[model samples]
Target: MTTTSPHPSRTTSPPHLEVTWTDPVTGRKGYVVIDRLVRGVASGGLRMREGCTLDEVRGLAAGMTRKEALHYDPGNRYIPLGGAKGGIDCSPHDPAADAVLGRFLEAVGALLKHHWTTGEDLGLRQDTLDRVLAGLGVESSVEAVYPLLEDPAGARRRLADAFAVDVDGIPLPDLVGGLGVAESALTALDRLGIPRTSARAVVQGFGSMGGATARYLARAGVRVVALVDALGVVANPDGLDVEELLRTRDALGGIDRSRLRPGDTEADGDTWLDVECEVLVPAAVSYCVHPRDQARITARVIAEAANMPVLPEAEAALHARGVLVLPDFVANSATNAWWWWTLFGDIGADATEAERKVRDAMRRLTSDMLVRAENLGITPREAALVVVDRRLAAIEERFGGPGAHAAARREGSRP
Candidate 1:
């Protein structure tokens, strides 16, 4: 069967980035969808889990365009980035998991010649990465890899920091993820006329992205009610202590449920979706919010800090009920901003200048999207795609010619 997606909704969704593998032990199949490789090369982390579909990966690849474009360069606008991603559907305990991941790296590694770099995600851990690297003769530790390619102001490195892994602390407070999320959440709240002093929020994932957002929000005067890691959810309407929780979270981000207790009206999975608050931030795994919990959502604004954390159908349901979604792409733009400045800007400035550039970009993008949504009479999420689509349309023209733009316009216009 021809696997090509029926031409994307727009002419230049950038050919569905592809990489697939079948596990010899488990007999399950998987693929990756990397989109928009801006320079001569590009890279992104791979996700492994159930519901890890190509469609989801496609949406993530689409977000990469918005990410890369945030760093708008005089030349970046004209250069076509080859975006790529990889996806797999298997639990970490599945016997075939190891083999599937190994085969994927071997097959996908072919693109390394073209600047395609891949990292582990979801069910995969640092040990799994060590094993994969050993097999590939990548005789470098995570500690070592950063130094070889590390730069305080480089876009890729800054993005990595936004995920909360600072390199030698040289990139003090370097995190586009938190900056963008805080900016968007603030924008969403401001539109509803919520004062900064009165804002209250909850973060579902206490991992890199979630943790950063919580810290930034707290700094902005928003009282965070809960910060849950993978161990188990915890809440305190009076406000959970961020400092204590970070001390307990393991590197893989699993918290010790044994030593903790959840205070937000104890409920099972998906409980975070219904928490009463002004903003809801899902920064962890995907599909955490589904059909059953869509209606239970009580937050006035939903900000996406993880990659495609909300399903498309679920998003539409929320829209129908009048919930504002700030979009994962728009909220988590710091990663892209950091990388773009590194790749295209005069990166020799002091740390403050780099950070200023990031904040300014976030402020501009989120403010523009929020204002456009109001003016265009569309949801914030829909307005995000409008800005993304317009830039994408302009980039599509640089390829094999003008027909691509026409095709993309028609696809984008689809209902």
Candidate 2:
């Protein structure tokens, strides 16, 4: 399906394609939205949740566009792909969840073959998705982009090797996004004239992203005061044991109470906003911070590790109150960019290389965005959008528009 908007420019245009799939056996619904297509393929992740909708997937796909465009560098080997996202309307804990996912993948096999490349997202695990794909005889969730590779075999090997490499018992792929978040948070703190050693942080999730962010921030001398998960808030005024908490997390990100330290206290999850800290990382769900929630936030900066964590009005309110919101696209873009950088040979499978690239890029991007925001007298999200717009235009000018490749293929010509 396409959008009904009258003014269909690149940014305002409806998705290039949208598919709603219903699992035959379980009757579960799944959605795929391709917001834009660069070189005939779009990239995003597949999320499973209880009430996942097309509109949510569409928003995520659009965010993916901005995330991809925000990382565009003229000299980099990893040209940004278009934006796409898939979501299934079923809880990951449901007994039929895997079957629903398998059926959805089978239904969208054609798109996966050539147009949409995906991986894990909220409520989904990469290993589970990979297992499902393997059972379906699919080579990889990223197989759709293989045709664009200079050396598909080498690219595949590099990504596989990178995924196999673990840092502090966490896989490399899981650490990169949180690494970016930590860098973005640190940059924001630096810009605000705050020292990392003097700052405190409360992260609202203990999953892959939040766990990694807390670990890195603690290592960087930021006192990680609290962590909120499905259970509730785990707090330690003098800084929780981040590595212990990380080691004790379940697959679904819930903390194992058996591992809590004596000084740590548990509280209601909603009290996360009340935590006194210099940085708050909302690394779990989207639209978590509404207008009312904004007033409760005491943090100097909010680094969004989750996509669309803060509502626009809440962000505006926070901005009015001098809270710096490092936008999601700018702050949490490292994971997607890292995947491409490694696959395209801009970086290697080594942890140090990934760390260096993510740190450098995030610092630069956050600094640039903040500077732009100040110059334009706007919020950081607006500034990041401005950057995305300019980069997207440049990408289009050099590579042509979304349909360029398809048009070329139809005319029996190379794109």
TM-score of each: 0.76, 0.96
- Candidate 2 matches the true fold with a TM-score of 0.96
Question: Where in model 2 is the C-alpha error above 4 Å?
Answer: 1-10, 407-415
| Top lDDT model | 2
Candidate 1 has a TM-score of 0.76
Cα deviation in Å at residue 345, candidate 2? 0.7
Off by over 4 Å in 1: 1-17, 25-28, 34-43, 75-80, 92-100, 124-131, 138-175, 256-267, 343-354, 397-415
224-253 per-residue lDDT for model 2 (tens digits): 999999978999989999998788789888
Among all windows of 10 consecutive residues in model 2, the one with the lowest summed lDDT is 1-10
Q: Candidate 1: minimum summed lDDT over ten consecutive residues — where?
A: 140-149
Q: Each model's RMSD to truth, in Å?
A: 6.9, 2.6
Question: In candidate 2, how many clashes are counted?
Answer: 0
For residue 79, give model 2's deviation from the true position in Å: 0.6
The residue pairs in collision within model 2 are: none
